[model samples]
Target: MLRFIRLIIYAIFSFAPLASAAQDAQLRRLDTIDDNRGWEAVGRLDVDGRGFCTGALIAPNLVLTAAHCLFDTDSKARIDHEKIEFLAGWRNGRATAYRWIKRAVVHPEYVYDGEVGAERVRNDVALLELHHPIRNTTVRPFDTNTRPREGAAVGVVSYARGRSDAPSLQEICHVMARQQGALVMSCDVDFGSSGAPIFSFVGGEPQIVSVVSAKATVNGQQVALGTQLEVPLEILRAELAAGNGYGSTAAGRVVAGSARRADGAKFIKP
Candidate 1:
């Protein structure tokens, strides 16, 4: 996985570094309610009690994250969705809202092959439907936007390994390059940052442009890699609408919330 990630970074390094002035933003913890305002939708995803990744609410009940987060890190087998939980706005050991994933749908092209590459990163997106909708006064879902261009300014908020108590915000980061459908940015991200949303503040509103997929180094400079959300996001949404993902009832049950259904337990299309 590490080697393949390096390869992806290397291939895009010629255009990977942004201006030094645009690369110094640091992660600031959003530990207080005031500090966490407008970002209550970003959450920590607990997958099957084994490990965690970052996720964010995109709708009343739909949580967006990386597809790889649902697979076991060791055996590469799919993890049971029943044990997964979404802790929105987690801070001081608590969350603004807690909900269990009723079902999840990964991008049709994503696969957890224990390796990473630009192609793999391009398709690394998923959507999990919560058992109940989160309609809070403060915890509002964010809107999605088109892919960002190189050198575009963006920001990210996420819960990582050492900063798991609350999600930290990297207020300013530059998109370094776009290779195929993958994006390389100068954002600070680590393991738990996977599925963390990358936001573009156009028109004074935050819209999701990408999600952290992997971290890599190019010429000793670290960078965050992610997928361009415009296409894969729609794909996952369509899959969920078709009732092809795992539903809230059981492992094999699939429901499009109120309409469609499937007869299998598999969440990812084989």
Candidate 2:
């Protein structure tokens, strides 16, 4: 009788893993941005036409994204500011607003070569100043807010590898954990989704609370990682205002870390 009970317990645990995987597979892609007017503010940051990362307009001329997006993966050097462009409401080969980047500022504490960790991810946020402000009625910038508590409901709008031409909106994801300035969420994100905005609709309209930095597998489930934007964003804004946060092409610059996809999980950046 005891032996029979053990066998049943093992069988039940085996099915638990399958259930988790099913949940992650439910993320859907937003094929059209017609009804997603608010999502128009979220756009793709094309890096020298070589690669892309997701970014969102926080101010008229200021865009927020991941710091790693500013570095070249091969050269490990800072890409020139003139090489980047912001495509607001990009979908199906069309964009609502296209603007060139004039300047950019990464978190002062962010180290491009540092290993992925709580501190590194926490400081992975970046701010880009557009050469000209996006002044269109359809392409309004989003507002930033304080980080949400653990277990809070959130959403993410991004452009990823397979769905590169169009952006996707995951309207329902939850913050699984919040520790050391990083948020672990159940949101579905993949390559090219880096720097995507994580929003909370607590009061009414969606407000950006975090920015996607990496995607990882926690336990038997896949999850997305994000940087809490409250403090780091303020610091970056100040640094840019002081003209001290611009990238340099000096030698020995650290390259951005590549995405880790060995354990059925991948970092969502180039």
Candidate 3:
């Protein structure tokens, strides 16, 4: 459980000076999105105004994010759908489009048991249906693609803890390993990075191949964990189409507000 630590710490002590310098060079902040026209589809998801996670526009009215974001970390209950908001292309306190969540669907296999493992991470995918579709010409939804092979070049765009106000792009990261429906990548990520999209550049167009679920140590180096989206994403889409995956808001269960571990990162779900 303690084996996976968010890669943010690597900036301070995990790498040799030369390697750290190289990493710093690759991960850059997307301060003003006007300069990063390609990343306007990724946005911040404010969950019930209590916490936030990164998400990306996948369709006119659908947003892709991590399954855990829909539940209260402390209560382990499904958060009220009405409380969630999607700030598309959010940056510097402004958003290209803002909309409320109407319904959400998590992978049927996803369980919020507060565990961290390959299976849990692999199934950590979710989709949100917005009350209104984002038809902005500048903020088009991203296209999804099948998972890339091991050692393939990948990239990530995310907004995390300290950099919560703006998104950052790690334009050059490598898929370090692929095992049991999860991809271990040498990407820099942190607490709020969960649900951020992992992209593969195919035909010079960025396509989402995975979603950040957790961070871990691989061979003594920090790496981000993501769900291989092919199958899980299809299952979630089907569930949503059938109108069966929305979480119940009933009041009987114990509702922990938000589960935060001793480490800065939150607990991995399912």
Highest-lDDT candidate = 1
Off by over 4 Å in 3: 1-25, 247-270
Candidate 2 regions with alpha-carbon error over 4 angstroms: 1-25, 247-270
List the pairs of residues colliding in candidate 1: 102-248, 252-265
Candidate 1 on 152-250: residue-level lDDT in tens? Answer: 899999877777667899988988888879888889998788899999988989999999988887767788889999999988888998999976575
User: Which candidate, 2 or 3, would have the higher TM-score against the true structure?
Assistant: 3
Native-to-model Cα distance after best TM-score fit, residue 243 in candidate 2, in Å: 2.1
TM-score of each: 0.88, 0.82, 0.83
Clashing pairs in 3: 73-259, 74-256, 74-257, 74-258, 74-259, 75-255, 75-256
Question: Per-residue lDDT tens digits of candidate 2, residues 166-261?
Answer: 788888788877777877788889888999999998778989999988776655465777888899988988898798765443332223663212
Candidate that beats the other on TM-score, 1 or 3, i.e. the better one? 1
Please give the CA lDDT of all the candidate structures: 0.81, 0.76, 0.77
Error of 3 at 134 (Å): 0.3
- Report how far residue 37 has shifted in candidate 2, in Å: 1.8
Question: Best by TM-score, which number?
Answer: 1
Candidate 3 lDDT, 78-126, residue by residue in tens: 8887777787877777778887777788888888764455677789889
